[model samples]
Target: MDEFERQSEERGWATAKTLAEALPYIQIYDRETVVIKYGGHAMGETAVAKQFAADVVLLKLMGVNPVVVHGGGPQISAMLDKAGVKSNFVDGLRVTDRDTMAVAEMVLSGAVNKEIAHWISVAGKEADVRGIGLSGKDAGLLTVEKTTRTKRDPDSLIEHEVDLGFVGEPTKVDPKLIAGLIASETDDWVPVIAPIGVADDGQTYNVNADTVAGAVAGSLHAKRMLLLTDVKGVMDRNGDIIRQMTLSEAQALIDDGTASGGMIPKLQTAMAAVRAGVEAVVILDGRRPHAMLVELFTEYGAGTLVKA
Candidate 1:
């Protein structure tokens, strides 16, 4: 055979080998629920967004129900800037005032949410997947209360409440709508959710996307919750990635000041999900191409998995 023909044959063989290896992993998660928090580079970059959508479509075709919860921090900030509204963040949580909340709602539910769904719907090479864009307010999906943080005063050592207006945490997540969407037999549908919820007082609140994803997964008793961020999973003090850790190990790391900053909230969300009945929660680098697929279908996996 010619060199070109020989190379083609080798490539075909490799493809077959990969499919053979992935079959068992595919079977293991068949018909299982996977909650993915898509953000960071994966959402911002066009190429990465296409890659992520294709992966989500492939998962649905494989019989895995993938629920995507997305964050639009940059988009919100950009819109706020355009509107000449100053934004503030405390302890990595955006302090959403009335104007900021308005901008956030518009960007998250109206723009980012639909854009992600559209990407998934059009990215499928084989069969086009249908994506349903949803907000936490849709069908009472996420009901939240106003969230508060306690800050200790320097020198005085007095604890005081820091009010983050229009910012809330998931108090109750009604998964009925999501369950119905995933249960559709004729149409394979994926839910793309924006983390905009409502409080008891009929006020709209912008919630942290990671926390929303974890809450939804726990509510659904999902098989896995994958948090896709910019970091290389959980790192040790020496700047090495720890492949896996139990809930206790993760907490210990946080207590020892090994995991700080933004990572603390992610780890805390993971811990909450696992404790609430999710089998495992993974914090992985979203910038890596096909990171979700690699973590799910390969033996090596892609990130730090926290489990009970």
Candidate 2:
């Protein structure tokens, strides 16, 4: 064979090998539900976003149900800045006011949600691509309660409550809508959810996407819950990534102050999901190409996995 012909033949063989290797993993995940928290710096990149869509579509075609919950902190911040609104944060949660909640709902549900669905629809085969954009308010998918945090005084050593207006936590998750989408006759509809929930009094609340994904996974009893963030995974004090951790080990990390800042909330979410019956929770770097596929199908899974 000529040089070009030889290269083409080798490429064909490689593709076959890859498919063969993935067969077992595909079987393992078949008919299983996976909740993905998609956001962070990764969503801003066009190439990565397109690749993520392709991955989710492929998973569905292979009989794995993928539900996506996305965040838009940076986008909301940008919109707020343009609107000349100031934002504050307490313990990593945004201090959302009434006006801020309105803008947040607009950015998350109106813009980010549709954009993610559009990307998935355009990247996959027309016959199989059915991306449905939703928010927690739709069909009451997520019921939320107001969140309160406490801060300690350094001088007096006293603790008091801090109110983060319009910022809520998921109190209940109704999985019917998501389950219906997954159980569609064609199995083509994928749910792309924005983390905006509604209270019983009909107030809109801005929730953390990670929290929403965890609650959804727990409610669905998903096979896997993947929280895609900018970081590689949970790390040690030396900055080395921890591949796998048990629920107790993860709790220890948090109790010892080894895991702090943004990671603290994420680890707590993972712990809650595991306790709620999820098989596994992974905190992976979304910036990596084919991150989901690699984590699910590879032996070395591309992140930190917390399990029972």
Candidate 3:
């Protein structure tokens, strides 16, 4: 029994050692930016939050440039109610007036962005984190137009377009500042971006978290766009994880409706990034402890890997 226990311990240590050995390969892609769209259950849960912070620090220490983009829909909605402002949603997209958009910029760029930066620092990392939180309005970073929806109805038997007012898709992103950040002196500086893009006329548009990250990855031509979601990955009909696939395969799964529900949009964003020449995007479960570090540093990572 003692020998058996000794063997088990040795096996565990061997696995961990092997994972550490793989780190150098990952570092070869270091300073090569990877856009992580952080949100969902991971953001709300305390344990997940702390682990994510540690993960960011670890990534930076490993010489990887991690640009964190966050979502705050739940926070925004709560604030709006507190301010006695009426809110509306169209196809899971919030309808923002000028007032609401102002609140969004303030909250996303000011409060949430800084708070995340602070936490990332407090995680025992002496990072020179320059949290230049901006909406699309600053530096013409993101351009937006209204989101047009195409939905096929079961009863009506027709597909048509519906204009979701103030709901936007990012038409373009100005990557100048992002490039500048990666080129900055500090090896530990990580840019925490809040997902709000601006139009030509200096109007701020509320962009979705995934959309913003995808656009940034596209603009930077990042090696990876790692979306930190709650799920392990895209699951089949029986809810088993799809480990690896090409970008085309992911789209086909969506087309066949095999990947339905909330996973659709997330996978769609990943597909877009790959198509735009981002090397790959992985949808990993952020709820797991050290998932980000494990994914990047080890060959057998958690969740799905969508390659271009």
Candidate 4:
């Protein structure tokens, strides 16, 4: 055989070996629910988004129920800018007012949500699977309450309540709509959720997508909650990714200041989901292509795994 044919044969054998190794992991996740919080660079890049869609479709074909909860921070900001609406952030959470909330809803629930579902649908069309776009407003998926934060006054050494207007925290999560879609036998469906919620007073609120993902995963008792962020995973003081940790170890990272900035909240969300009965939470970098599949199906997972 020529060198090219020899190389092709070797590649084919490697592919077969990889699939053989994945069998156990695939069996472990069969008929299980995996809640993926999709955002970061992955959502913004076209090539990465297509890969993500294909991976989700592959998971569904393998009998894994994948529910996607997506965020549109950059998209929302861009739309708000085009609308000439100024935005403010307090403690890394957007201080969403009336106008801001309207733009947020338009961008998140309408544009971003549909785009993700469309990508998934396009990827799964050949297999007869499709993506269903949803939001917290649909079928009572989520009911939220206004979120409040406290800020410390530098001069007075005092703390005061800061109102993040129209920002919400999930007070109730009804996963029945999501459950029904994934449980259907005739048609395969993937639910892509946008994090726009409503309050009891008939007011709309913009919720943090990470918070929404955690709430939904908890409600569904998902087998795994995968938080796709920009970073590799939870890191040690040396900045090396830690492969696995229990709940207490994760808390210690926050307490000792090892986990800082946005990572603090991501860790908190992971802990909360685990406490709420998710089997585990994995924080992996979304920028890396096929990161979710690597984390789920490989022995050496792609990120930090946090468990109760």
For each candidate, give its TM-score against the true structure: 0.97, 0.97, 0.87, 0.99
lDDT of 1 by residue, 1-308 (tens): 99999999999999899889999999999999999999974577788888889989999988899999999999888888888888888898899888888889999999899999989988764485788899999999999999989989999999999999999999999999999999987788899999999998899999999999999999999999999999989999899999999999999999999999989999999999999889999999989888888999989899999999
Colliding pairs, model 2: none
| Models sorted by lDDT, best on top | 4, 1, 2, 3
lDDT of 3: 0.80
Error of 3 at 55 (Å): 1.1
Please give the lDDT score for candidate 4: 0.94
- Model 3, residue 107: what's the lDDT? 83
Give me candidate 1's TM-score against the actual structure.
Answer: 0.97
Q: What Cα-based lDDT does every candidate model obtain? A: 0.93, 0.92, 0.80, 0.94
Off by over 4 Å in 1: none
Model 2 bad stretches (over 4 Å): none
RMSD of each: 1.1, 1.2, 3.5, 0.8
Give the lowest summed-lDDT range of ten residues in model 3.
Answer: 124-133
Which is superior by lDDT, 2 or 4? 4
True-vs-predicted CA distance for residue 101, candidate 1, Å: 0.6
- Model 4 lDDT at residue 304: 100
Model 2 residue 121 CA deviation in Å = 1.1
Ranking by TM-score: 4, 1, 2, 3
- By the lDDT metric, which is better: model 1 or model 2? 1
